[model samples]
Target: MTIASCGSVSALTLGLPNSSAVPAEKATLPKGLFVARIPVSAKTKQRLANDIETITMLSLLRPSNTRLAVGTRIPEVLAIGLRLHAKNAAIPTDIVELIAMQRKSGIVFVCVRDADFEGTKRQECAFAVRRALPGRAGHTPTFKVFVSDWKPAGEAMLDIGDPAVDSIDALWESLCSQVMLGSASPTALDARMTRRMQAAQLAEQIDKLTRDHQRAKNPEQRNEIFTKLHKAKNQLEELRKLEA
Candidate 1:
């Protein structure tokens, strides 16, 4: 019921109940929210995406879609799907709660390759998510989930439908179209990317100013551009540190 964790920007739309339906007073359900920190890296996104696509395709190709039922909740369902996909790929994710609960809001998904998914990967992902969260003081219950060590590619392809998009690509597109995982991770990444872009623009401006300052013939003009350049660099540094 409208479960929310502190500092989580990623909202979960799990066909879940809201406060009105589940109610805070009802003590029947779990108390704490689980925050999944997914630390997705740019290096391994394509590989991970392909693997997820393959698993999803295989699942769909199964005679019965509901063969590996996990739970009714969207996260739970996806978690089970991920587990199955990971198992097939020989990937391992060490976490007690496969799915994050509502109590924690921040989940970091990192891109990982098959070779680097083991050891302290989960801790690293969680640390990354915690850094992404706004506050450092609050006690938001959290957990880590690993996406590393996923299969390199699917076993095979099946042309089940009409429009001729590659099955892997199509499956990936379908996963992105989902409400929870789709919106949460991508949206956070989008926000982060936007900040990075802004910082880059500021850095570019500072560089231009530096060049202008050097080219300036007059002392007054040189000093003015230097001041502007200094301010711009400071701003860029601040922007970059927001992620840290």
Candidate 2:
């Protein structure tokens, strides 16, 4: 846990507003639980994405979110969220690297709100977000954040415990005492997210090919995609086993 003074990482993730080179001073004691909630009176409502970010910043301030529940739709918040939640915990190096890699890879989940959320299903997605409880994933113990938001994409529910994501909360708690913003405009998306979107699109292509092979009337095409899918499934299984 102390290999690389994680206190610096802590400072960066929690919006200290200092440069990376600047060292952080010891934090003062906590005051009280300050949740931001917006009451609708003169204003109709704020933009979803902006509101999500504002609330996210508030949740990360204290760094102890065990009792806090954050909700957002922004994907950029994942890196910040992960870092914030990871500060006090002892995460293994492999998981830490994987997190850093995921942050670098920028792969994101897009919630599919269709009535038939195929990606959100247990078997389809390979993991059950709601059932994972809190603060970990698998025997590997992926670092967890307290504000767990379930994003239903297809049949797979991308368990977005990260506060950085905008698609996390369906409804922002009005009295939450924070600004609101969810799933910002594409302009607001970071480079990491853009890359993630590209990767997702590629995954979709592969998925279609596999499904087409399954549904193909022609035996040749069906065999082609089926073979590919079999290889893919096996590869994913191997990766999971490694993570496990």
Candidate 3:
């Protein structure tokens, strides 16, 4: 079963039906299709997972690996092991359905990590898998399930290993932009919008200077480069806002 929410670049994985035996139905199991303007809800989440399972299973007839995520936050693990199906194969129709089913099987994992896994190796990943599989598997694969340098292009299929990643707002004056757009609300979009502006501007400066010694032509060009450097510096001076 192939499940997808196309609008956002999501790195979520839901463990359900093994993609190997699931059947495909084109009308229901569309891959990466958009569901624009639909408000998020419990029911909607369940439905999406179901659809994706169908699609995932549909693809399984071709001999793909049974992979899924186990969202965790041990700081030692990335996503965990499980099979991700596109069709509504192994997935329950609702949160209740899933939880209820867990008593018979196990908890359903939902991955919510970003594109990068922060930098964990295969051995570390194996440890993570062992941690999750306390007593489930009777026959573990010979090869430890881990990637050396996996950088996902799409949220595609992934294991939502263990809970959310521990993110902290390590506010440093350094990352903040030097220029304040205004005394705007601390949570306004206008203020927060400058964050990326600041980051990009800073990135360009770093790149320019690193290559400046190699490719930068002259001092005048360098000064122009520096001017942009500061603008980039103040790109995120404003604050963030939430209207809702």
The count of residue-pair clashes in candidate 2 stands at: 42
Residue lDDT tens for model 2, 118-195: 434221111111111123334553332112233222222222234532332321211110111133222322332334
Query: 1-244 in candidate 1: lDDT tens per residue?
Result: 4433211111122221122122223322221122224554453443344443221100111113323222222211121122122322333232222323332322222212223344432211111121222223577733333232222222111112324222333322223322112222223443564575588799789879988988999998888898899899888888878766
**lDDT values, one for every candidate:** 0.34, 0.29, 0.29
TM-score of each predicted structure versus truth: 0.29, 0.25, 0.24
Ranking by lDDT: 1, 3, 2
Can you write out model 3's per-residue Cα lDDT over 151-175, one digit (the tens) per residue?
2323233222222211211111101
Cα RMSD for predicted model 1:
18.7
Task: Give the higher-lDDT candidate: 2 or 3.
Answer: 3
User: Which TM-score value belongs to model 3?
Assistant: 0.24
Give the Cα error of residue 23 in candidate 2, in Å.
22
Q: Which stretches of candidate 2 lie over 4 Å from their true place?
A: 1-206
Better of 1 and 2 by lDDT: 1
